[model samples]
Target: MNKKKTSLLPKNFLFRLTFINIFIVSIFIALSSWAVYNTACFLVDSMGTMTGTNQTKFNKTLYYYLWIFSLIAMITGSIAHFYLTKRLIHPLKRLIESTKSMKKGNYPEPIEVTSSDEIGQLTSNFNGLAHQLKKNHEQRQKLVMDLSHEVRTPLANLNGYLYALKNGVIEGDPALYESLYQESERLTKMITQLETLKEWDYISEQSFFEKEMAPIGKLLHETVKMFEWQLKEKQIAVEIDAEDADLLVDKEGVLQAISNLTENAIRFYSGEGIISIKGERLANEYYIAITGPSYPITEKEGEKLFERFYRVDPSRSRDTGGSGLGLSITKEIIEQHKGDIGWKTDEAKNTFWFTLPLETACTSR
Candidate 1:
């Protein structure tokens, strides 16, 4: 049998105060009872000696007085305990009720606590948490909607082509087959891009593996070789202006980051396409900048280039075979490196540029 998940109400500082107040009132009652009995005995003794009354009579009178005192003390203590408990617990009841309202998916107005005690602090914290949670929830919903729209189009086309082939809706020709295959490839690429974005999202909120001093030249060498085949097909010339610069980084991750940018350069920077890899070091940071030619790019578009799934020219990006997440992922990686990444685009010559930070060593770009 599956166990049902149940949570107990969270205890707070007010609960602790209730227990302490009860204990203190209990001790006060005990002390007050002892004092009442002693005073009654003292008065009874003095009256017996002064009036020369019989011991039995004095004892009876003292007994009656003690009884009356006990009765009054009991009533008074009961009333005080009830009052104290009401004072302490009423605010908490208000808080609990307000919090329950939040469970109904509304950010309730915060309950005001009068005492300058821990409960007041708790109320403030609760309000802050509710605001933050609401913001994050809204953001998550927007992200889901965007991703669904992005992933659905290619996937629908891919499924449609498969359906056509299976039912023989059209003649079994090579062009039809090829078209289906291309659509499938597009769908697969979209999935891969989504996965990459998901991984970075995970990484941003997770404890990273580690960082070490890594040489940029070697990282670039390996990355270039990995994508060398694609660059060759495009006939895009690649140039490196990097020297031996060691940067503090996660080596494999940094390589992946640079590869994403370079891939963009190869794909979009066309017609005398020059991908210049340049680097320079400043105080406490080294900068690696990628200079490449772009098409019909504007300054405003360049500023928003790193936004998720945002493309300067969607048709150009899709035709050149990219999922538009390349720049976004590159931005994430750079941010993880404790740095910033940005680009500038020139409309005349059609050039796009991006830079990365080097935290711990030499400079290579």
Candidate 2:
């Protein structure tokens, strides 16, 4: 199936707006002309009857003057509309062209427009989106390259092992056999994780999960318990502060989201790093606050943290067995559960958190 392109030609937002304005002006002009003509005739009829002059002759001159005045008014209004439309059309065209270039996978070039109006707001938005898209595209391409490299290493080792065995270069020693088995298993696990990520992303994209009344604390506990071994192994201390915490969300979807987030925390935390999982029910919403031990999450990195396959430290990330989709998939799942997600970072504090709705949890609160 062929896809239709949204960005191709320069759209005229200003021209469209001017067209409607012109239509309204024309209607007002017509109504005003009718009223003026009627008033002129009324005055001529009243005064002409009193004077000793030809009433029909005076009425003819009055009608002629009204027609001339109407023509002049229409012409002036049209010229004004044209000028306004011109002022609006040029910038709009520039914006449309920018969008088209971006749609074609061109990183948007820097655009500067000084006009302070709705059009300027649009320009700012366009520039921001373009910048993000360009950054994301570059990062995604790099991630794919790195991931392929990672996967290839294990597979190549396994293939060489098999070739050696077949050619009788290496005997069927248990140690060599175990090494081959381990490499193949590592490759298998990587494939499984990638597949699971793809499926989670698909489900999230389709909006398959629907909102429901869910016990957030219980799910958090369950997810945390599942990672108990990893948490204990790392000497990471976890503190849970749950008082009145419930949310309106997709049950399984929310569980999967927090699980992914916690997994990420476990992978990144240092020895003796403290992890806190807290939940609070606000008047209109419920929030799950997951704060892990600090690493370098700068302000800019926070913005792109949820982006697909974005890694802060590629070397450290690979060492920690991060596939880079854990946080990204968690973000998508939270959105699907009819919730919101965000992170905070600073010199002293770096917390990854998300919020769910409390509208349906009114009773629980």
lDDT to native, each model: 0.69, 0.72
Write model 2 residue lDDT over 171-290, tens digit each, in one string. 888898887777776666566666766666567646355567766778888889999998778778888886555566767767878887787777777534578898887777777888
Per-model C-alpha RMSD: 6.2, 8.3
Q: Report the number of the highest-lDDT candidate.
A: 2
**Quality of model 1 by C-alpha lDDT:** 0.69
Candidate 1 Cα errors over 4 Å, as ranges: 1-26, 32-98, 107-136, 167-169, 206-209, 314-317, 347-365
**Best prediction by TM-score:** 1
**TM-score per candidate, in order?**
0.70, 0.53
Residue 140's lDDT within candidate 2 is: 70
Total backbone clashes of candidate 1, pairs 3 or more residues apart or in separate chains:
4
